[model samples]
Target: YFIIQTLAAAMILFASTLNAWQTGHWAITYPTCPLTTTIITTAIMMKLGAAPLHLWYPEIMQGATLNTALIISTWQKIAPMSMLYMMHKNLPTTLVLLTGLLSTLIGGWAGLNQTQTRKILAHSSIVHMGWLLIALAMDTALATLTLALYILMTTAMFTSLNTTSTKTITDMGTTWSASPTLLTLSMLTLTSLGGLPPMTGFTPKLLILNDLSMNHLLPLATLIALATLPSLFFYVRMAYMTTLTTPPTTTNTKYT
Candidate 1:
């Protein structure tokens, strides 16, 4: 991890050096320096945990404590995404589009077999970042809205999981007895996270898809929608574990 961070910092420094050399200024907005812009966007993409460069995110989140995991999944995303937003117009459009598509596909595919709740959420974060990237390509306003909504939903999930001390799918199966109300809320939260209709999560995705289609990106939009199915399957599986199973006889009342 230390090596990765160091490499990322070096990439960013190299980009800055290139920008300074070409434009005789240290600012990030160099219209004549496409190479510098590309380098900076590449670094930002890795920082955001976008696909083909996202191998560390799930493992790192898995190793963190719940509070630390929550911070990583939510707050840590802000800096890189904010940078991406600032550079959206200057960055390479094709590269951003490809990164978004691959992240969407890989994030969902990688999480399907994970039992660890934190890793599942980590992958889910990557998937959401993919959507955000797509939206950023179309409209910065919409992307900002998506990012805000994602943070809200993720915070709710992490808080509930922390309260319950849930670590895995099997641990979630026993959550009902501890706090039925929390379990119920978690189901709705997961449903929203899956972008199911009539939920808050569905609203942003619907808008983004419409935008993509209007922009003649129908094929890409269709692919993103299809990729979401795998993620929804896992969300449903987690919901089932939390809500469908009966409480064990040895259930504790401490959380109730």
Candidate 2:
């Protein structure tokens, strides 16, 4: 993991060096060389754990503590994604679209069989980043808004897990006994994270899809939507475990 992080950092530095060599400037706002721009975008994509370069994300998150995992899922994404957002206009549309689609597909598929809660959330984060990348290709403001909403939902989820000390789906199954209110809120949070209707998480996706359709990206939008099914399935499974399952008879206290 350390080696991977070091390599990613080296890529970022190499991209910056290219930027400096091409424009004789230290700023990333405007790059004169096309290769430099492409390198920066690719490096940023890798840093954000976009698909094809996201192999390290789940493993790292699974090994980290809950608080560290929370930081990796939320705060660590800001700089690279912000860089992507800043350079969206200059980036290659085809590359961004492909990356987004791959991320969505892989993110969803990867989480379907995972039992570790952090890995599940890590994959969820990748899926959200896919949506954000797609939105960024069309509208930066929309992408920023989507990222903000994701941060809120993810924070709510990690906080719930932290409070309950849940490390896996099995641990989550007994969470209702710890605190029914927390379990209920966590269930709602998971539902919202699944991007279901009437939840805050759905709003950004709806707007992004609407924008995509308006922009004649209906096919891409449809594919992204379909890729979310697996994620939604696991999210509902977790919620069911936390909220609907009856406590075992061997428990000391009943959850009423």
Candidate 3:
């Protein structure tokens, strides 16, 4: 695939640059340490839509159906996580925390004004990955647990949305009279995506914050928490629009 090849080419280019930068007088030393590893891993993760580089995902997801979006969000996005795990020993803590913090802030802020359902979910995914990146600096056991839980929660939400072909909060709210259960679940899922407790999304967020604090990255941890507030606020707004807002007159309801 073009994407895979492009990624390979990028990796090669990055490696070449690193070699050129860190090379000795006549030879090159492939750097292998926590700081180097973290930088490399974080770069790769950004390439894979890890955090600040996550701007493309929502727009791309919006262009696809639920099935395709699910694949891209789940299986396809795992490449970076796989890379992170493989290079865990060398990952830097400071860079990881910074990436996580920035990702969370940007993602949540960007989602605040979105009206399109897919864009909202796309931004939500970015925020979730931000949390995940933060969690990666924690113990491996916790990271795995967080990832697994994220996959399940996201999958369930997407599956439900796909089943009904729901694309916007208005689409959901107006149709609630037809399927209350779907609307309710969608609300619950939105809140869950925002990292609210009593759902699966909370664990990863808690773990990320806990890990960051333990590592003495308390400021970063606090920023992540603050960032999540925007995510929660926007989703709650969407929920209110979907479940409580009265329908307005529309000559045509077709997506455009």
Candidate 4:
């Protein structure tokens, strides 16, 4: 991880120096500098934990406390994403699209078999990053909205899970005894995180897809939409565990 961080910083620094030398400004002004732009974008992708370069993020999140994981999944991505947002005009659109799509797919499919809640949320963060990237590729304003909504939903998830001290899916099954109200709200938050309709979380996704289609990106939008299904499944499964899943029924123990 240290090596990865060092490499990313070095790449970004080199790319920034090159861009500044060519344009006399330090904020990625040279849109035509493909090599520099790609290097800088890739470095940001690494920092943001977007896929093809996201393996470290989940593992790190898994080991952190709930508060630490909350910050990791929410606050940590902000600066890197801000960089991407600022450089969207110079970024290779195709590379961004491909990476974003791959993130959604990887985050969704890999998370399907996970039992650990933190790992699941890590994947969820990756999936959200994919959407945010797609939005950035099309419109930075929409990407900003996606980031805000993601922070809201992710914070809610971490707070609810923390309230019950849940670390795994099995732990969710027992949360009712800790705080039943929070358990119920946690179910709603899961659905919102999944971007299901009528939930606030769904709003950004709907607007992003609509914008993508308006910009003639239907194929990309369709693929991203399909990629969300697996994630939604896992979210629903967690919701069920939180709300409806029942423990073994103990018979009338008067006889025992």
In lDDT terms, how accurate is model 1?
0.89
Among all candidates shown, the one with the greatest lDDT: 4
Write the residue-wise lDDT of candidate 3 on 1-256 in tens digits. 3464366447645654665566533221335433445456646665556566665677787898888888777777677677677666556766776777777888888888887777877787777777777777777778788778778877877887787777877676675665788878877877777777877788777877787788887877788888889999987887787678767776877887
Candidate 2 CA-lDDT value: 0.88
Q: Model 3: clashing residue pairs?
A: 34-90
Q: Candidate 2: TM-score?
A: 0.94
Model 4 per-residue lDDT tens digits across residues 140-184 = 889889999999999999998888899999888888787778887
* Deviation of model 4 at 153, angstroms: 0.5
Whole-model lDDT per candidate: 0.89, 0.88, 0.72, 0.90
Q: Model 2: per-residue lDDT, tens digit, 136-245?
A: 99898899899999999999999999998999998888887898789889999999999999999899989989998999988998999999898899899899988888
Local distance difference test, candidate 4? 0.90
Q: Please give each candidate's TM-score.
A: 0.94, 0.94, 0.82, 0.94
Ranking by lDDT: 4, 1, 2, 3
Q: What is the lDDT of residue 49 in candidate 4?
A: 87
lDDT per residue as tens, model 1, 152-216: 99999999999999999999987887787898899999999999999999988999999999999
